[model samples]
Target: MENKKAIKLIDKILENLDATGINTDALIDDIKELRTYALEQQVPLVVKVLRLTYEHIEANQSFLIPILEDENDEELAEAQEVESTPVESLKYLIALTRNLNNKMNISDLREYKELLMAY
Candidate 1:
């Protein structure tokens, strides 16, 4: 599949449950929170990559995002803004993912950088 790297990243995330001894549901919930925070922080590149990985997870038959009846439109719009070209977006994603890997002390997210490099 063209999304192989994305799949790999998701697998590693699932694997982290066992590795880190975190509960599965709790981890997913935490990731959802991080996703929301990343959006609010206006890190479009990281948000884009995270969304893609979430899509891969959804495709595997798991629900992630909750259906919110009232989401703040202004906040969402701010998060969607892409102030850079695709190339620049990828660069930012690479740097941010590297930062995430270092902070998490897990090399799993490195796949995201590798996948971006292929583009």
Candidate 2:
């Protein structure tokens, strides 16, 4: 059950990537790091997922995260969050992918490791 859900998350990311053509590099690094942490700390499966995801988000801070104060208009800021650069988006995706590889029941990790080279 947990494996299914974890795979679903990866699928979700891949789908989003296909639609948006986003890159995924920095996110992969975060994911891999979080997996190590999860195993060492004995975190629960669900918590591990969330933690890894959060770390992925955190790893691409400049990209995934926006500078709210830079918004020119308050209404626009309030109504819609700005999207990051395409490169930034890809980095975020990579981070998430690596996290998935570490925490999920994945068999071929080397391929994932190789794919996480660019953002």
Candidate 3:
């Protein structure tokens, strides 16, 4: 069975990201709480992803833009294709967190981490 607690936490984080105006402090707090939970669960990959995500957002708060619900179809499509961007990488991480199978691709996470480091 999947860990419902983790899924709920991830969903909360995603919802915060989707909000019109993101409160950076709250987001960071949520990420830290999730990372602690992952560590307790002994999920190293999840912990790493959360740590990297926290760092990326902390360093680039001003540059971080939440994906809007009303964005044009073309822009959303473009965002999905441009995985190198930080925002897109974050979105990808959120998607990874929501995987029903509870299997996160390490390679993809590594790639996103590298991309985040580039900025």
Clashes of each: 0, 9, 0
List TM-scores for all candidates, in order. 0.35, 0.27, 0.66
Q: How would you encode candidate 3's per-residue C-alpha lDDT over 1-119 as one tens digit per residue?
A: 14677778878877776673345788788889878877877767767777877887788673243322223577766666554444444655766755525433555555555655665
Give Cα-based local distance difference scores for all models. 0.43, 0.43, 0.63
For candidate 3, list the clashing residue pairs, or say none: none
Per-model RMSD to reference: 16.2, 14.0, 5.7
Model 3 residue 22 lDDT score:
43
Q: Runs in model 2 with CA error above 4 Å? A: 23-108, 111-119
**Compared to the true structure, candidate 2 yields what TM-score?**
0.27
Identify the leading candidate in terms of TM-score. 3
The digit string of per-residue lDDT tens for model 1 on 1-119 reads 11344334444544554365333364445455555655665655556556664443445333332221113585654554543333233223323443443543123334453453333
Per-residue lDDT for 1-119 in model 2, tens only? Answer: 22444445455555555565433453454345545554554545533443444454456542343222224677765544455554433434434433443643332232323333332
Candidates 2 and 3, the one with greater lDDT: 3
Native-to-model Cα distance after best TM-score fit, residue 19 in candidate 2, in Å? 0.8
